[model samples]
Target: MKSTQLTSTVHLDYGLDTLFGRITKSAECQVGLEQVEHDPTRFALRVQPPIPQDLEQAKTVLVKVDGRRLNGIIRHTERLEDQSLKLEVEPE
Candidate 1:
């Protein structure tokens, strides 16, 4: 038996539902965020404080691993359970 890593793009959702924990994300899935900076000199000197991780939105892209270039994958915004959507990859 041979072991190989795969990669590909997955169609997923990071919609509002995820923000409320209504949806789940997968271990393979990753989250994207934007860093915001606040001026302390302002009257309300406050910042969001760099939060390591914040459930924001979901995204799908081509993932390459080992020697596989997978395509047509899907995932969620948050991890509700251990499940992922992958396409049937056939050897050419």
Candidate 2:
């Protein structure tokens, strides 16, 4: 699908399992949003640091951006050489 790139700040909420128990972590970061022309519910997001590890395996990602709340499932993930994480997400 064709995509248009845009920039925005977002809050990512995810759960992490620690030695104690599962904990929720919230990260605020700048992200590049690639909106898919054919499918508005599917897009690619690129984010930098303060993000959780093993994010692709996360059950669900709660994204708050552009005054909209989205629950996304990570379809794929790639770690760029610049240390940024690229993820293909499908909103549910």
Among these predictions, the greatest TM-score belongs to 2
- Per-model TM-score versus the true fold: 0.22, 0.64
lDDT (10s digit) by residue, model 2, range 36-83: 556677887777765565664554567765566766677777788888
Worst lDDT 10-window in candidate 2 = 1-10
Error of 2 at 15 (Å): 4.6
Q: Which ranges of candidate 2 are over 4 A from the true structure?
A: 1-9, 15-24, 36-41
lDDT agreement with native, every candidate? 0.27, 0.68
> Which segments of candidate 1 are over 4 A away from where they belong?
1-56, 73-92
Q: For model 1, what is the error of residue 29's alpha carbon versus the real structure, in angstroms, after optimal superposition?
A: 9.8
